[model samples]
Target: MIVAGFGWRTGANLGAIRSALASAQQGQPPVTALAAPHDKLALVSPLAEALGVAMIAVSPSALQSSPTPTQSPASLKARATGSVAEAAALAAAGPGAWLLTTRHISPDRTATCALARSCTEGPAQ
Candidate 1:
């Protein structure tokens, strides 16, 4: 499975979320699931519905524990990671999953997205 995870500011709209997803999916595999910190479930549910994928709510601890190569000062302050999008994607994609896309933010910076592929799958056949 490929999971796309998101992180967004409060009051972020569907447009911002859509833009972030578009940026993250460029040259990437189709996403099979959507993920975000549990508190952002309400914010991401619409995106999940639009994508026709299950939305996975990642725990804050899990997000913080997941290793990511990118980091932002603001994200570190808020979630103890450089990029919540990357961490959440890694955490939700299950053990052995790896990032397929780094965090991509919308123009307004209200939303961010990252993608991860499941461990059970190899590169595209």
Candidate 2:
């Protein structure tokens, strides 16, 4: 199965999921996701409709983040915690689990580390 994930930012994840789905050699259904509330996922309705896939939000806290239009400490913490949790969850999933996040992850970032771990541990040779 071709599994993919998306972050709150709409465009990037939508395109990534669509590309992954399209590139699959095996016939697999594409699934899109919202970072938080189910209602928020509706924002991507057009993409969902276009891809013929449904959007699902994981956890409410997952949507919270740091770095607002103006940056602050609390915002930073929120972003860090939420990102860490999100990455951890994705890492725990099975192989071929394509986790596409809209957040820009650095090389040593938590999300990046988690994705690397998940991809290595989950996917079967």
Off by over 4 Å in 2: 9-39, 61-125
Candidate 1: lDDT over CA atoms? 0.91
RMSD in angstroms, candidate 1?
A: 1.1
Per-residue lDDT of 12-107 in model 1, one digit per residue for the tens?
Answer: 888998899999999988999999999889888988998799999999999999988897888899999888999999999999889999999999
True-structure lDDT of candidate 2: 0.35
Point to the candidate with the largest lDDT.
1
lDDT of 2 by residue, 30-93 (tens): 3332222344455445665676644445453433432112233442464444443233224333
Model 2: lowest-lDDT 10 consecutive positions? 108-117
TM-score of each: 0.95, 0.36
RMSD of 2: 9.2
Evaluate residue 95 in candidate 1 and report its C-alpha lDDT on the 0 to 100 scale. Answer: 91
Tell me the deviation in Å of residue 7 in model 1: 0.7
* Candidate 1 backbone collisions, by pair: 71-82, 72-82
Backbone clashes under 3 angstroms, per model: 2, 3
